[model samples]
Target: AQTVTQSQPEMSVQEAETVTLSCTYDTSENNYYLFWYKQPPSRQMILVIRQEAYKQQNATENRFSVNFQKAAKSFSLKISDSQLGDTAMYFCAFMKTFMESSGDKLTFGTGTRLAVRP
Candidate 1:
């Protein structure tokens, strides 16, 4: 069984500042993909970043990056130069690497509601 945990229920960051959201997970599978998804008021969840368990380098996007500590089973998101558009509920998710006949499903954390203020 695999599980994702987000300790903080809510977080706040000022515009132009940076914020790091914490996430932890438990999984026995060696090959997997970790992701951070953001859901705004519209309820559409958007992919923020993704990290592969076997990859040593962390994944990053324009303003989003992940600090993946595979040994510790930790994957956290760092948002740089936060903006109001970044305000959303962020979820941590995990999915095992696809196999021909595998029935793996995504396991998600409770989520952290982030507010970017002016």
Candidate 2:
């Protein structure tokens, strides 16, 4: 089993700026990986990024990026040029490598509530 932790329960960032949310995880297995998810007021959880354990390079998507330190078991998300629409509850999640049909066991962190201020 894997466990993810988000240290900050709440964070605020100004619009058009940058913000990074910190996350840490514990796992005994080596093949499992990490993911960042964003849930807005609409109550939909969106996949922000994915990082495989063996990958040396961090995963990135548009304005979102991750600082993945496999040695330290840390994965943090960096949001560049933040926007009002980015205000949401961000979660750090973990999943073991499994067949897509078998179903994924995702362990989610408590989540960090982020607010994008104007």
Candidate 3:
């Protein structure tokens, strides 16, 4: 079974500052996918970024980036130039590769609530 662990339960960052949230996982599969999702007060799960296990380079989107350590089974997210609107509950998810004929479901971590203070 694959499981994600978030050490921080809550984090606060000043507006315009940068923050990194920690996440680590345990998986025996060699091929899989990792994802970071953000859920604002609206309760909608939004994909922040994704990384393929086979990719050595980390993935970045705008001000968001990831530090992916495959051997260590660690994947962390870095948010730069943060804003109040960025405040949300961030979740780390893992998904196994599914066959073309099969369906897949996402497994999520407990989540870390981020507060961007103005």
Clashing pairs in 3: none
lDDT value, candidate 2, whole model:
0.94
- Residue-pair clashes per prediction, in order, are 0, 0, 0
Instruction: Give the Å error, residue 3, model 2.
Output: 1.2
lDDT string, candidate 1, 16-110, tens digits = 99999999999889999999999999999998888988899999999999999998999999999999999999999999997898767889999
Candidate 3 accuracy as lDDT:
0.95
Better of 1 and 3 by TM-score: 3
Best by TM-score: 3
- Taken over the whole model, the C-alpha lDDT of each candidate is 0.95, 0.94, 0.95
Which model is ahead, 1 or 2, in terms of lDDT? Answer: 1
lDDT of 3 by residue, 1-118 (tens): 8889999999999999999999999988998999999999999999999999998999999999999999999999999999999999999999888679996788899999999999
Off by over 4 Å in 2: none
Give the alpha carbon lDDT tens digit for every residue of 14-57 in model 2.
Answer: 99999999999999878777999999999999999999998899
The 10-residue segment of model 2 with minimum total lDDT is: 96-105
TM-score of each predicted structure versus truth:
0.96, 0.95, 0.97
The pairs that clash in candidate 1 are none
Model 1 gets an lDDT of 0.95
Q: For model 3, where is the 10-residue window of minimal lDDT?
A: 97-106
